[model samples]
Target: MSRGRGWAADDGSAVAEFVMVNGLLVILTLSVIQLGLVLFIRNTVVDAAAEGARFGALADNSATDGIARSVDLITTALGPGYATNVTASTGSYLGHPALTITVQTPLPLIGLIGLDNGLEVSGHAAIESLN
Candidate 1:
């Protein structure tokens, strides 16, 4: 059995094609996963901030309490590192008194770690009163 002259020139091309395709697929998959991770982290942080603001807006609670609550939520969900930069303040939102909780966290470039303070989110809740 003999092969054609053109077949010899095309030998080993499959291996090269497979490598390139595989590389591209791997990169695409990793990119999708990373995007999902970023979204998850952002949502978690946002929820924590909102919950903290609501908690702090309670008549018996204060801005400091809100900050503590936000910190605790983020710490438990992600880790202590992400919770370090949380802050809370009392102010007016939509013309009504409110509490705001702001969270600044890493941008998560490569698996749960990235540029520090690259992302920021805030949550606000109306302040409760007994009057």
Candidate 2:
């Protein structure tokens, strides 16, 4: 009768196993969510900057317009804090007069401070004329 080391002495391995597995799952889920947030923020900022540059490139617009538009877009989508470092300037794109809009914002990681310099993104559009 007998057959091996008897089906007994089942230590607390199941509990430890569950803990390890669940920990990994939780970490993985959080990482995925964080990545998604980063991507969404990047897209939103880039599009906002581009839209601002386009607006400023209109026949009757100035670099200030681009700055304002960018700030407004970012503030509306994320928060006013994210729009604090917006800037606009005149430039040339492909030999054509252009307006450039730059945006720098915090990339929230653990809390909301993120890196010391955060992330910076810019957009440019050729100036339009009504001649």
Candidate 3:
């Protein structure tokens, strides 16, 4: 007697493979997107910090000016929440005066949630003929 074609041992099937592969693909896609966002945020914040430092270092400006500029840039580029932690300071580098800007923004983990003070970046500029 020949076994019927429609009946076979019920075992692992196509559905299971599809589910596994699809889930992996979704995870990979999200991971790539998240990485891209983090990179963008980092670049924006760093650039803002540099700009702030330069502004503060100028003859007509103060550290507060740098801080404000940095905060504004960050707020415009990212959001208000990212702008709250910017600060600027003055010091000496290479035996000459300098300005520094420090920024702390949220580190992105699973969508806008990360450790407190998760990302910290700073920038410096030489004092420009402080008068």
Candidate 4:
């Protein structure tokens, strides 16, 4: 009789443990995926900024051109939302004239939605002079 009672008490414990473990595994998997997405977004934005700076540093290009390039690249790669805060200016890098492109974007916390202007990156390229 006592053995029968013990067996009954243990009957549903396996299902409960399974549910808890499965929940933990699912959360872990999602966390990893979200981290990967954040990294990918950061790298893409950085590359776009650098490319825009290089483009604007060309002898024939202007700072506004660099801003436009960055906006276009970001919009195409991510979305219009991520490209909204791009800016460009003339600056000096390593004691030489340069074009700088700055990009501010959201740091995604949950599925591409996150804090506004939480992530920022800049790119610089030496200005080309036709001397």
Highest TM-score, which number? 1
What tens-digit string does per-residue lDDT give for candidate 3 at 19-82? 9999999999999998988899899999999999998888899899999999989999998988
Please provide, for model 4 over 20-98, each residue's C-alpha lDDT reduced to its tens digit, 9 standing for 90 to 100.
9999999999999999999999999999999999999999989888999999999999999999999888877899988
Runs in model 3 deviating more than 4 A are 1-12
Deviation in Å, model 4, residue 41 alpha carbon:
1.2
Query: After superposing candidate 1, which stretches have Cα over 4 Å from the reference?
Result: 1-8
Write down the lDDT of every candidate, Cα atoms only.
0.94, 0.86, 0.88, 0.93
Distance from true position, residue 27, model 1, in Å? 0.1
Query: Candidate 3, which ten residues in sequence have the lowest lDDT sum?
Result: 2-11
For model 2, how does the per-residue alpha-carbon lDDT over 73-101 read when each residue is reduced to its tens digit? 99999888788888888878789888889
> For model 4, what is the C-alpha lDDT against the true structure?
0.93
Per-model TM values vs. the true structure: 0.92, 0.87, 0.86, 0.91
lDDT of 3 at 42: 92
Error of 2 at 9 (Å): 5.3
Scored against the true structure, residue 35 in model 2 reaches a CA lDDT of 83
